[model samples]
Target: MKQTIRLEQFERADIRSALAKMNRGIERESLRITSEGQLATTMHPAALGATLTHPLITTDYAEALMEFITPVSTSITTTLAQLRDVHRFTYQHIGDEYLWPLSMPCYLNATSDIRLAQFGKSHVGRMKTVYRQGLTHRYGAVMQTISGVHFNWSVSDELWPLLAAEEGRENNADYRSERYFGLIRNFKRWAWVIPYLFGASPVLCKSFLKHSSADLDFHELSSGMVYVPHSTSLRMSDLGYTNKEQAALKITYNSLDDYVDGLRRAVFTRSEQFADIGVQTGDKWQQLNANILQIENEFYSPIRPKRVADSGETPTQALERGGIQYIEVRALDVNPFSEVGITAEQMRFLDLFLLFCLFTESPELSIECQQATEKNVNKVVLRGREPGLTLMDEAGEYSVQERLAHLFAEMAKIADVLEAESSAYHRALQSFAPAISNPDATFSAKLLRMYEEASKIFQHVGMRFAVEYRDRLKNSGYEFYTEADFQKMAAQSLAEQAEIEAQDKGSFGDFLAAYFEQALDKKKRA
Candidate 1:
């Protein structure tokens, strides 16, 4: 059944303040994962700069905290950025990757374009080496960045017994069954829960851009992510709300440039026009980019997961081959600085770089590449410590050094062309080219070169800031946040959902009543 929640009479500024505070919370929570004795950044890099030693923790701790937060509306009024335009403007990726009605690869190649494959195979091994070199040269860590993005999950004391029992089981099937799809299933039924419910009165949505034969769906990746209010340093309107509600806006962007501009207007605005208005948009795009690149299944596609001819193998073999799913890019953190969490300069560079991915694509989705990507994801998430780890790409694998050099040279070429053509975006891309070209000498490298530079405490600030911002919006402005508000919204949404679910069946109210009654009966018996 679809469940919706509304935030009524909610102000926006308060929510913004709360979210800004949350940055610190994320940093603090990550501290628990680091080795107690170590004082370096938990985010490790190939070198001390990019990677840092950290510990293992579950998201339950974070989820519990989020529950206390509020949500808001974004569809109505959140003037996003529209900074200096760039060349080759393109917005949301135009691809055959839709959520439903399965959009698969077509002109880009359904099975695989031989021309692209030929180009890819020719450079597969070399590309692999360059990917490593390029990453290390720039960041020193094989894994680029740990994303601020997140999915939601809940596990309470009541489930401890089941958790304990599941650990004892040989495989994690039982645990997976119980926890995996709860959030995704919820999204499929109800999506509008995003804006209609989020406001000073009520409150806060994920999807994929691709369609793999038998891979993970978009919802599966970021189900816990609900619409929290989005406010930037530019406009703390969201902070006006007392409730800690976050929100999202589904906008139409013509090109990547448009998207970047949108981000600037939405979250990262600090112009003279709004000078009278106090806003606090930070330079979150840099951080957001780092996070997005590493999403489980976004940019890098090492091994294709599809129902290949099921060959008989060991117990694990069957599950792996048949387990067709792709990674998705969600869990993106809102950059209070930018509308969509990134900047124009950053976007300009990213467009050129990401395009290179499409141009020099690989033919064989090698297991090694997939493994490398997995390693990269872990390395970035847990701190990139694996020495000499390679990034998967075309032109064969190269040591980190070799791969980076080639990228530097190629980027230079792209930059020069843009400069001559006088493309505004190309110029932006060109400017960053030099810095990124010599990533070996940038702050990115410093991050990996040094250990424990930033305090974990700072990381946790993002979440707390989110909550506080919501509170401010509700208290100072027209927004409101309280468990009571959630209960009311949830109840209404749940009721509506129940009705829909009962279609062609029994009454949804009856189902809930019986379910609750049975639960009470079970409790009494116990």
Candidate 2:
């Protein structure tokens, strides 16, 4: 049963070359704010490009919430440089608005102030906006406005053959998908370390709680700031992305089929709660449908298996045609200390952790174990920096400090092999090793301390970083992409969006029916 490969398995040339050439991409979201530190009421800047067809820049839930995407590359420094260039280019077009630095948002009065992201007149573009409308009706706009960074990672194809041989399985596409699922299972079991080491949202503005119905005990601070003591990231807590409705779905990751089938079922399954909201009122559509999910992406998780879908193809359809291509890590908070919301060291650490996950023993995750894993993450999100905190594991309860040390020791072994090509892997591990024993040295702890020293005014500390980063990026200029390159891309995106609109030939109802029909057809084939 222990046929899993060891850290010492990198002996062959193919394996060694594969280990050195893993690819990574980044997607970071930040809200546009005014000089007074209020949410920008303006529409998405036209100079950036159409939100629907843009390759590099787009909008998230709100019109003011900008999402920047970096193309995939093997080098971590290049990935970071692309992100920085995106920020620098955006600053030039945004006029007076500053990109909000913290994961938590600025002041807000009500949901109406937060406009849904607008796409062009094309059917597909309209569907994207309608999805956001569904989210606002279902989860409220405030919660959806919280931002974070997503890391998309995949190992080399050559490494997969080595893994398939070690497991005594055929070197096929399905085996690759299954092994990626195994990595995901292990990632869930040990993901708490991420928020502990890189979390930056220790406090939030009181405006975030204006529409909240949940009863949470929080200490109030001056200037409408409120927080839980010693919390690492309230953004990852129940207050943020943790949704009760999706939690009830219990999507399993035992295999690729299990994962895909669960998402498809959830999309088709009706929900009484959503039914009450109603799908449409006359010509205006309020939401997509009265289902547990509007689409596959509605079923939220800390991580997801992803494939780049072709035009008119659903995410599940793409996965069915081709096995999982990569895994997107969605647990990271935007690091306020960095101009780009993430550092090269953080990316290197993630690479080591993911490599460790691939090589570690990953058992099938049961329902009870899944719940326990979630509880572990929740504890870390709320009280990770608290002294003597313990978490539940398969082997009874264990102190977080002890578990982190053991995990890091294991990661160091993988880093040892990886550093043969570049010392960046080992250097990144050493950078974060101190946070294991000394909780005060962690990012969350430092953010909390600075917030308190600023007289408990959340924005006092956040706005400072926002202003500083804005000026630095504006003056630093571009790192990778030139101004002409950005302008051409933006113009081309707008032209592509216009062509899509011009090519429309069907009614809105017909378009909706066809889309749903395709989804149902894929499920039937599965």
In terms of TM-score, which candidate is strongest?
2
Candidate 2: worst-modelled 10 consecutive residues by lDDT: 1-10
In every candidate, how many clashes are there?
A: 164, 0
Residues 171-273, model 1: lDDT tens digits? 2333332222222222211111111111110001111112112121122112221111121110111211111111122211122223223332332222232
The positional error of residue 186 in candidate 2, measured at the CA in angstroms, is 0.3
**TM-score, every prediction:** 0.28, 0.96
Per-residue lDDT tens digits of candidate 2, residues 460-492? 887898899989989996878999999999999
The TM-score of candidate 1 is: 0.28
